[model samples]
Target: MKITVLSDTHMPRMSKEWPAPLLQDIQDSDLIFHAGDWSDISVYEELTSMGKVHGVTGNTDLTMIRGILPEQTIIEAGGKRFGLVHGHHGKGSTEANAIAAFSGEQVDCIIFGHSHIPLLKQDGKCLLFNPGSPTDKRRQPQYSHGVITIDGDIHAEHVFYDSKS
Candidate 1:
């Protein structure tokens, strides 16, 4: 399965649409995961139009989004279980907070977003991934997103670009 991951889109507040490269990635993906901060339901609607979309509701998300999506959940794909969360606790280190979100869960990977920083790492038995912000990079050097291909084991990578235009 080819899974395309995105987070912190903050659309309309970020961009009206995805960049060409990211759009192509979404078009070619088998599954899509949006970590959160989507801002508008249209972002979710647009992604769903492209393919299957599984997502969480962020701290910044409006009532409609929060109502429709869970703050955290688990999804199974390609026989691997993934923990999804917006990863915001409003206190200390974002990464630490993210890891803590899935502390007692039995997920193969924890996928989250909040700081708009791309990350992929392993801690103990599970993998942690933050796809960053394809639309809102914040102070980051480049816009980015993540792709995970699962055959036997999961192979993940980040595709970084200099511009959204």
Candidate 2:
């Protein structure tokens, strides 16, 4: 199924709105996954209009908001097993070894967002994905944000959006 993947958006603090490019992807997607660090649930509410949204909470997600999201999420979609998490204890800001920790979940795919970086790779039997931060990009030269699609083949593409007129 087409999945609009996003993560690590600090929102309102980093940018005013969601990226424009992502809107198209979200519109075309059958489902949407937001890895974490939303800063507010309003973003999640807005994105749900795009499609079925599944999300988790980040480290900065505050105690009040913490109860709203689970640290890990598991979903079965299109005959695929999906494991979702914010990847907090997994590792530091940006670390491969840290992300690898989720590889052991025995899921067909693991979707996570932490460090505001997007990554997609075939690690063992699972496709690990991170859509990075749409709002809180921390100066990564790529400065990118994107989504992941899984059907016959696997895809992880960068989606740049213009939130301003």
Tell me, by lDDT, which candidate is best.
Answer: 1
68-94: candidate 1 lDDT, tens digit per residue: 899888999999999999889746577
Span of 10 residues, lowest total lDDT, candidate 1? 89-98
Clashes of each: 0, 3
lDDT of each: 0.89, 0.70
Instruction: Give candidate 2's TM-score.
Output: 0.83
Model 2, 1-165: lDDT tens per residue? 787778887766776676667766777888888777888767767777767888887777766557777777788777777888878764454445335645456678777777666676787777777777766667554445666667765666776543421
Model 2: per-residue Cα lDDT at residue 43 = 72
Clashing pairs in 2: 20-161, 20-162, 21-161
Off by over 4 Å in 1: none
